[model samples]
Target chain A: MTHTQQQNEHLWQLMFEKVAGVISTKDLHYLEAQLREDESMQEAFHAIQISFGHEDLERLKEDEDWIDILSVIKTRPRTTHQHRFGKYTVAAVLAGLLVSSAGLYFLTNRKTTPPLAAVTAGESPQAVVLQLADSKTVLLSDKTTNIRLGDVQLHNAADQLTFSSPDNFSVYGGQHTLIVPVAKSYRVTLSDGTAVWLNADTRLQFPFSFNGSSREITLLSGEAFIEVAPDAGQPFIVHTPNSTVQVLGTAFNINAYNPKQVRLSLVSGSVKMNTHGAAVVVKPGMEAVYTPPEGLYTQSFDEKTVLSWKAGKHFFDKASLSDICLILYRHMGIKAVIDSSLRRHDIHFNGMVDKHKPIQEFMDDVKNMTGVDYYFDAQGILHFR
Target chain B: MKRKVEQHNDKQLLRRLRTGDPNALNDAYRQYRVWLLVVATTYLTDEAEAKTLVEDFFIECWDKNLFKDVRVPLRTFLFKTLTERCKKQGIQINMYP
Candidate 1:
């Protein structure tokens, strides 16, 4: 290379490094000095930046597809094995049956038939049901004004169920379970003022009032976003199937959809996650995933994607066809049966599904994107071929 | 004026990207990967190395969570980062002017 070419390359290297935030202070000083003295160097830098944005470059034809890039990234070796669903693939299939059976158990074991007032006309089969401490199950509807069980009174309005106790004392100490079935979500305010937004197919068990030294609740299954009321004197503790999250006052999300794994994403404040006697402190923007036998792993997460379900949307990135079908079943109450050939091929989907929209819209999008046709059987089971 | 609108849209895309939208990432990759590859190939003669450099730029940006801190226009930032990666490979930029 000629002397002028060498000089220009050096200047270019400095500018690139500056943008990358790796240039040394001395090199930056040198580059600044050269820019001050040489107007041509400034012009060259401008040209380089502009040229990078040009669409019609010589090698532009060699560009690869986004899927190719995703494949490369996915196949690359990682320092840790953090595949959330790899270990549970077999268990997940079995767990699918278990989830349905469990749902059946809840349905058949209702201690009392829902009262006429609580059962609105055209009530959904998968309506939100709240089991009082006395074991009486009341199917929740927006028209239900008030429910009194012992000393705890619940005010039901819209999708929110707020609990109010006549006194702070422990008059109603038995546990109450709120079961939100498929294709619906509900919010509940605990007697202690903490509010929890339960996602579809979730069951949360807590006492009518927190009477002990610590506030404790159990997430029976599925996902929830919780904002714990701050009380320095009393710590809040949530027990999932595989992990325990202890927080004094904070907002966070917990996903225990898979029986073997519990994913906790802290949005604000701090939380301590405990699994099999091992503990880790998770800060805001960090997610601690606890999968037993494999142990717990902490990593940064995107808040918007993780918390998107609260907004009535679920985002999937390269999620397997089976997993997508499972989510569709859980969130839409629609059974999806993929063709055997397509299932063997292991097709994946990348997009968002809005819970508020009809399942037909999602099916249309899937058909348009993947050229996979679908039809609803007489039984309303979706079959994709 | 059109360029300004495009820049504004890119900024919105980046914001969605920070929120962990995979669709936004795919959109960005489709929109800029070719230009980025061209920039990388301009500095390095070897096409394979250029491809690796461009891929690494995207990988590192995502894996290291670098895009969260990006303050410049997405296109400019992507170009500069790709060029920087090429420089680290000890390739000199081939100045056209």
Candidate 2:
């Protein structure tokens, strides 16, 4: 109200901006001193403090992410919603303008905001962490499934998908195999902040947390696209019995089913592919194959064929009918025994299986194409005699 | 007696709040408000805008008593709750209004 009181308040505003606001001992002292000197100042400070004491603030503070967030808000200007009272509102609103624009410009484009290159090609999705109820955990791959071991609902947005639970402070996925039968689809985030989009007949086992230096998940069977979260402190590694794929920040896919060797495809960023001492860095658009005895992964352009499942199509450039049958067995939930007489035959076929059709439709197509009569006996087994 | 929210943490606070304990509510507010404002400001930049945003957030918390089971930590609950609020307004938080 008085000129002196108004002047002191303005001084506090300037000081608040100067600190970029962590509210250190000095700030607390200064704010207290100003309040003691003038009752009106006490009222003014109380109004400002009111924002800091909001109930929402308490709930959010219990979350670990509010630290940097608090800095931005404390220093930003006030909005018109806060100003309905008058001139004080105008200054607060104007100040809010500058702080918010600065905050937005920084956060929305922090990586690409001129000074720093976005670290990657474009705005990639953020990392997601899935926590289950019982404290047990599992990372998900685009190829693994049946993770019904926890009580949670999963949703995805960009790179970050949060798992919300009614009975948990943390969600659990213990070591479970999520078999996403081929032509079918499923999605989930592991406890360590990785997002997996699994394709048909895929299965993998993941722990709740890396718990060790390296974050690891074992791929058993199927194809999956993974957007690994970036953590410079701890590198993310995917493992099969014979190979290891290590990356810090990148997008890639793995097809390391048993009996078929292992395939790792890099979509973006970089990856180090190793097959027991034979290793190489796989750049974007390259696929690496590693198998036992052969013990080494060769690289090439099977990139398009690799990601075909992501696009909801099967890419079998010239795959053998036996291998194709294996794919069908897992995806269609059937058991097949191909005629040994036909084993040595080329077995190779080239065509796209849409997976969107029923198993009978797929069997029909396979029977028509191979010109072989197939019969399913009472035991749920298919015999080609 | 202020319950510790036996079903989870913070649920007690929300319940205490439903009965109108000014100190408990203010304590809860003090613990969360400014931080909420900051996170909200990232998406809703104007000061008047930020203040109003915080006000609405408090209003919502008061109305819903969302701290039910406290399934996630308070901060996660707050960030998620505010993020949803910002999203509903079709405006990003900690950014321009």
Candidate 3:
């Protein structure tokens, strides 16, 4: 460790000592300033912060030392957070840290890794921050945040949750899950009012705030139905799994979740969809298809088959059975598997598959059309051959 | 919007277990083994033993008609009881009340 490294460790020990008490704005500011002096220090501070994201600061709040010493620090909710990051703590301070889901910690008392020197934005990046219910914090972008795999919301940068309708929220700074629970979906209405309907199993990210003259968000592989809120001031942009859609307030759908292709369907307004640096500006009712050779290229498409899910309808215009399954899996978490024997069907399907019909009914119809048998287990394991 | 699916409303199954049905014991445990492990995870330090102990707790619950009170929610009661039992068994609950 370097001199700065020793200083960083000393800084952390000081914070830990004060953590047993209420840290004042002055205390926090002092620490933050010490960190802001060097990128290494900021990374060091965050590493420590992430480590104790799961601490029961509530117990710390009740500690005589904490209660007796400070202002803006004596509030504890009924429950803050359980296990966040790798550590689990349960307590509250003026700005107490919180964690959502928890599991056993296998590396307790382990030596800490060297602090990250610098955290950089992606060349093609997707970023977000959560505004948690409590004023505490978390990094949603860390792959480690996928601690418990299930439908769970993680709030990163708030003290209280005040979202009823779509509000401007951040996907935490790290790997986060944008979970849309069953029976209800979330319409992420950005500050620009570009409504992105996040399906049940989807996760995406936008920076805490837009950058430069363009509004941008990156899709790190998940399905989202985006209606770019038009702003003459700043052109809205969505960077998907493969393609990038630039629009000036247009109603469009883009599915880049698949590796080989990006399907952009325009409902109204105009959009410039591109793949592999190529571009196609599309009018209303048209779709741009982009496929890069390394799975990155762009083309134009007649978008007669978009807006199916938005209108609560499944619009299939001569789509293949495999294509149909991909659509269903994206919008709904249903897995459809056809037996190898059924691969020869090479069948094209049309008409709408609405949410009303039990998935079994649709699978039955599919089986009849392709002469393939489909069975779903209680665990939702669907097998079709 | 929707609650966790861990909530199960299989009343007769619970009643059967409460009434000392041995076959029901094996069946229900098999069905809820995963969920119990998840619950025990919050309490037990040893991930491996947490799973095993949670399974054993279910076996005990099944044999004892732990779900005898239908009016009271079975899961809530079971979890509260599990917390008490685990604590007694030296399962350290870092900060649970």
- Best by the DockQ measure: 2
Candidate 1 local lDDT, B1-97, one digit each (tens): 0111122267788998787665566667656655555556545534455655665566556655567777765765665566555554522322222
Point to the candidate with the largest TM-score.
Answer: 1
lDDT score of model 2? 0.52
Model 3: how far residue B57 lies from native, Å: 30
Candidate 1 lDDT over residue span A1-385, tens digit each = 1235435545665655454333568879998888777664565455344334433333243333223556644665532333322221111111111000000011111112342223333223556877656554655654333544445666677788897776555544678788887788899999789999999888899987787899999998889999999998889999998888999899999999896989999999999999997999999999999988898899999999999988888888887767878888777777788877654445567888998888788878877877778888898888888
Identify the runs in model 3 with alpha carbons over 4 angstroms from their true place.
Answer: A1-185, A294-304, A317-321, A340-344, A377-380, B1-97
Worst 10 residues of 2 chain A by lDDT: A101-110
Candidate 2 regions with alpha-carbon error over 4 angstroms: A1-184, A210-212, A339-344, A358-370, A373-385, B1-97
- In candidate 3 chain A, what residue range of length 10 has the lowest lDDT sum? A114-123
Better of 2 and 3 by DockQ: 2
Q: Ranking by DockQ, best first? A: 2, 1, 3
Candidate 3's C-alpha lDDT?
0.47
lDDT of 2 by residue, A231-321 (tens): 8888888776677789888899887656357778888888998777689788788878877777765567666677777766676656666
**lDDT digits (tens) for residues B1-97 of candidate 2:** 1223212235565566556454444556555565455655544433345556665565444434444444543544555556455444422222111
RMSD of 1: 27.9
